[model samples]
Target chain A: MSRASNHQALLAFLDTIRRPDVAAIDLGEHENLVDSGLIDSLAVLQIVLFLETEFGISFAATGVDPGRLYTVSSILDLIDEFG
Target chain B: MFVNLDVGVLHEPLSGRRWEPARLRLEVERRAAHYRQQQLAPGDRVFIGYGNCLEFFADLLSVWQLGATAVPVDARLTPFEIETLVRVARPRLFLHQGELEPSLAPIFEACNVSPLDTDAVPQSEAQVPVSSFTLDDDALILFTSGTTGDPKGVVHTHRSLRARWIALQQALGLESYRRTLCLLPTHFGHGLICNCLYPWLSGQELFILPPFSPQVIMRLGALIDEHEITFMSSVPSVWRLALKTARAPQKGSLKRIACGSAPLTAHLWEQIQAWGGTSEVLNTYGITETGSWVAGTTGGPFEAEDGLIGEPWGAVVAIMKSDDTAIPPGYGEPCATGETGFVWLNTPALMKGYLNRDDLTARAVSQGWFMTGDLGYLDAQGRLHLRGRTREEINKGGMKVYPADIDAVVERFAATRDMCCFGFDDPLYGQNVGVALVLEDTSADTLRELHAWMKHHLAAHQLPVKWYLLDAIPRTSRGKINRDSVAEACAAHEPVDLANMLGAGR
Candidate 1:
């Protein structure tokens, strides 16, 4: 999948995370998912499942890189690399 | 310091003909070769949530053989938490050693595991290639509850975990017992290493059961008798229940009953001793970050002192003051023999660091000691006594609610205000969640409406069972609301005769 297409899918998944409407997540900006308070460890799972089916990639418990998964940019980059 | 405790003694009869370590390695190697054929690499991470004893050990040994790391996720996690961990750890394979419920069926990647799966074959005689590994190698990755903050993955290297097991061997002086029952899940620190791995590695046999229940322990009595079982370790709660409910065993040989993971109340300890099963009741102290058996009471002369966690096991303990300095002469923060502060340990068994969390790794470990967030003191006799944890106070039965979790739901209500919530002590539940509110209206359904909304959005445990309305919550000068004060205010009780509230139950 192209990075642009991956980004689109990522935005939709993030949108469904059940944050308050008042919190108003800006999908185009505030790229740091942790800092933006948009996603936390719980959200990470949904994203992983999405990545597995969408990108045809899998992760193992031992070789997980938190930095690659914690942030949206890094996650997209990881998907691109694995894809 | 002198060696006050005996290091080695066989407390239980042999459970079986002693199984040599070479035989175990051979079995593990066979399993490892099979796993490798399925494309699992030496560095890959896999989740072992299986509750079965054989699969747990074999999968673990397979990981050891492949020079890979195994992360055991507790199967008891609420579905939400399990989903969270699977994503965080990103295990390629999720092994179900126990029965898998339908809820977990959706997310779990299809695997060759599961006893009923036709694809899986038991390797009666298998061999694994020799792999290079060290004590410092990452052996296991376990997660903290994240009760207060985000749960971080704790990573223990082989060296650290093995050193811990060796220290336990020296501390408890374990001999391979004949039939041992494992009640705690493998995901837990105390159960996996202390109860299972440590015993198996020492040529002992382990009998696996689901988490402890009175019925289960009673059934185990027969197995113990059948197998000539000896030593057992379990959480105090399980033993307390077993003592209360189970029929007293007749003509059984259970030597040492060790309890840890939570405080062992003296009342409960005395009850266990009262039962015909006479064994040295040892109270152990350790955490997930510390590779299981860190400090514990020995079978030798031990004072029945309440709160004493005993001295460190083959490790050094330091009590640090609020200023991040070791308290001088051990009086401040309870390190000097009778003072209390934050407890820290320099041990070979400490985990290398939090998995993928360098920031947390740096904060928790400093100058070679892992700073356990638990608050406790060391008496002059060098025994440690824990007071409580430094993290947010939890009232599992009371009103100390997780504000983040509560607020997450309250904000969803149309008429609700963005307000702070906290927990207070409730007589019925240990801790109950109470929210300081600024809602538009106060009708009779206020409580009913709030409860209904929470039920849909929050887990039963996460819901605030009680609600308290406040004009505004107290805030610090820097603009952070002081939750401790809010909680204290909520806790302060007005003397009310029970007759008044219930009206003598008409």
Candidate 2:
């Protein structure tokens, strides 16, 4: 999938898991999901699940870099590199 | 300095800070002398507002040295919530490392309590006070609930705490705990009383981490392997993250791992065993009132089974038919083997009672046996198993968030006409907070104001993650809130569009 498509898919998945009081799409591309109050600490687990299921990104084999998953920009970069 | 405290080496792996026994003792003495200068005495309650570091332990021992009860406050609490507890506990000294929250200053002023800086200690290593404390005096008061209401602090005497440590030592030896890591918060009973203290106070090296930080959890295996941690205890949610994102520890130094305070399924239990490279992941059974861990899967050899609690460590586990505490010496006949009933525990390690709340204590304890609000049964093989809890608190992962506490805060808000907080099934946390609201106005302005009120009075974790708007909350015939029915009703309807609603107001 294209990087733009991956970003769209990731944003959709985040909207489902983000806190009810916050809009995931409203967050900046460089904004940290947790630090920016878009999601809870545990909600990161759902993001990991979304990566494996949708994009076939396996953290176990590639090793997780928390920074790569913290922001929309970093996540798109990760998809471009791994996907 | 006296050496009977049994405190071992304390380390913070994230910061790479370590305090040896001699250095720890000196730190404790300096802080103890500082407290003495501030006129801290026996029977006084000293609140430590921060934790998960070396200084926190020093302050704990220092408070004990002065015969004062240590109250470890959750720093996340809003100033309003903290003041509510301050009014109840009536602490003599509020110990924090640095500046108090700007809003918290007035509370100390009105309450006439001193906020002592732990870092600003006496220069000399003061000798232990003469006749400072006894084993029967209150050692710690860990608050379980009622942060925004009447806070219920579980008071454990030094004797009871020692009983817990001794009992744990007798049941679960200290060899495997030679190097232990704790990721749970120190304000919690399971974290302070068992996971941190049981091993650390038994003269073992303790490695502490900031509680529930995904960054730290992401590198959990590396932290464990670097420290060569032999034993660690955490909730299943943590294991869920570790098993997925973090690389498995390669050193194979894990002698045992324990998951408690939340339900651990057989699938997840086995997953933890594999990820940690050890088969000793025991699903521990404990509560704040019982001084944390009372029972776990420590009986001989056993396969991981759903709800299997194994056996008691230093307590007599009984499954009873009746939990009518209104009657004197409240207890009933024991259930037949393999029959589910109220799980009652008789332990020396049970908390003295709720701090200064005998009315609440009376409702929970009867005779010598404390009626645990848990429902479970014993197998023919003489093992205890947990089925469910009858308590009103929402178990968000391992952290117990009381529903009434949230309701108490929300009800006080002008925009909230009626509110009911309940637990909903969550994939990551096992259960998360859900609120059913009957608001005075459904307009975005009122909704935003209500959200602002909640954020001010409640911790982020305690705030309802899911919200439902209703005409009125469904209630029982007698007008009591049935959380389950309200939860069921809310599940049927779509939740309020809080993000859009608040955004519209903005």
Candidate 3:
């Protein structure tokens, strides 16, 4: 559970679902969160339903690569290769 | 006139080869002899901006086999919406395929650029001449997904796109052994004229997909049984995210399933009829000034109703009155037979206007119908229904409401997964109700139990006096709902105690 606390618990769940005057920056764990608009395409389906309900994990049973769920160090290497 | 179909690329994440229909008509006649070696005349225009490959359908069939026009755009627009569409489509060729948004380099150096590359695919053997340009010329421009404003363009012609591919081959009987499965975005008209030019002019078999990710629509039941895919069309948010992560397709390899640009929630049309074990799900209706799908729903099993849509086909629909007139056909005019108003239409596959806006083509056409800023009704068994968008209705103090009846009571809230319901600037109701949402639990006790189930199924000027939550519900790259950015994120949020959560739900 520690990649700096999974990047501070994924930037505190993307600053509690972003856009309320955005602000919470520091994203670079290999940046690109959806080509830099910092998350979209429905926040990549709310980060795959927040890693299947906050880390029970299962991006279709870990065969991950939906383009490495678009960055923050490839979603912390897909939650350390599928949580 | 020559597109005898058989194109099959299936998974082109930037050229992973695989095309055939005689190498996609010899790469569309060597890109129509490089648009007749750049003299590009026969009614010019061009633009394209490619993306979902096969070299964006061979530069849109070599700019409609050189009778020219083909505008296309939307490679996720914005370099100020491609410099307001190259300052309103003054294109004599912009033909892009990659890299040209360094703020559109002086609008691609004032037009005439061309590089739509797949390694320039033209190994000669050129027979280029065929377009003496008739079918009254113009041939396709498309745009309008400017979610309730600005993006205009529209146009069409080549005899209103062969009367919308002969009204979708006489209302969806489209043959040539069907195949289909294209996955939207061919710069809209429901993915370039109903999923890729009416299945490439009804000589069918196209597979395409790539670029539409809910992990590529939860891998549509293994790409519809490895492309045996018999017919599909999208947008009901990609069949409600492929009925929540795909997987149900093995009964007779899915014979049909449509669901047009928006309206279709009868619980996602009965979960896309039990996940395409087929009742041929249809439920369409049209726009982009009437060309794409001029009304649908038929092919049996039915029950979803809320602007049900069902009957127009070659088109005529009416109901009018927001001053463009019509509403008089029978049972007492206030929009007779079943009541709602403003839908219109009249189609021979409409549109040949709006490009240079003649004041929005005289307020969206009049003497020959086409008003369609939507809001609908027809019924007493004539079928039409739709009831939202005449600028997203919701008047509050004068009472009008319809945000698809508060998105069918906030999509029956099992923690709501998407929703919009707009109309915001209310100085005591000149326009009020707001809404936003997109939750499966934005937890604050799941938004105070969805504001106590939308104050027990709405009606206090149809509730929602602003409430945003939103982790998504922005849309419009033709999945619609960008209701002016969900009424500017429900008028920049800040109304969340919801009167102590509707007085603690009574």
DockQ, all models: 0.01, 0.49, 0.04
Docking class of 2: medium
Better model by lDDT: candidate 1 vs candidate 3: 3
Give one digit per residue, the lDDT tens place, for model 3 in A15-48. 5544322344667778767666554554565676
Off by over 4 Å in 1: A1-83, B1-31, B97-127, B130-132, B147-149, B176-178, B217-228, B323-335, B393-506
Question: Model 2: how far is B488 from its true place, Å?
Answer: 1.3
lDDT of 2 by residue, B11-57 (tens): 99988899998988888878887788898988999999999999999
Candidate 2 stretches greater than 4 Å from native: A13-43, A60-63, A81-83, B1-3, B122-128, B326-331
Candidates in order: C-alpha RMSD to true structure: 18.6, 2.2, 23.3
Q: Residue by residue across B155-242, what tens digits does model 1's lDDT show? A: 9887788788788878777653444667776777888878877776665667666654323543444545665667777766555434
Q: Rate the local accuracy (lDDT) of all candidates.
A: 0.61, 0.86, 0.67
Give the worst 10-residue stretch by lDDT in candidate 3 chain B. Answer: B325-334
In candidate 3, what are the lDDT values of residues B1-506, reduced to their tens digit?
A: 54334554433522446676677777778778877787787787887876466777877777777778888876655454565566667677777754555767766676545434445546864675576577777888876633112446789887887787787788767653277767666777777787777776565666666545567676677668766687777766555455544566664687777767665668768777777777777778767677778888763555787558778888878785564433322322447777888777777878888777778777777665667778888887787888886555554432345576567768778988888777776432346677888787775667766766765555344667568776787777888776777777666666554434433433
TM-score of each: 0.66, 0.95, 0.31
Name the lDDT value of residue B311 in candidate 2: 85
User: Considering summed lDDT, which 10 consecutive residues are worst modelled in model 1 chain B?
Assistant: B1-10
Clashing pairs in 3: B307-B385, B307-B386
How many pairs of residues collide in each model? 34, 0, 2
Better of 1 and 2 by DockQ: 2
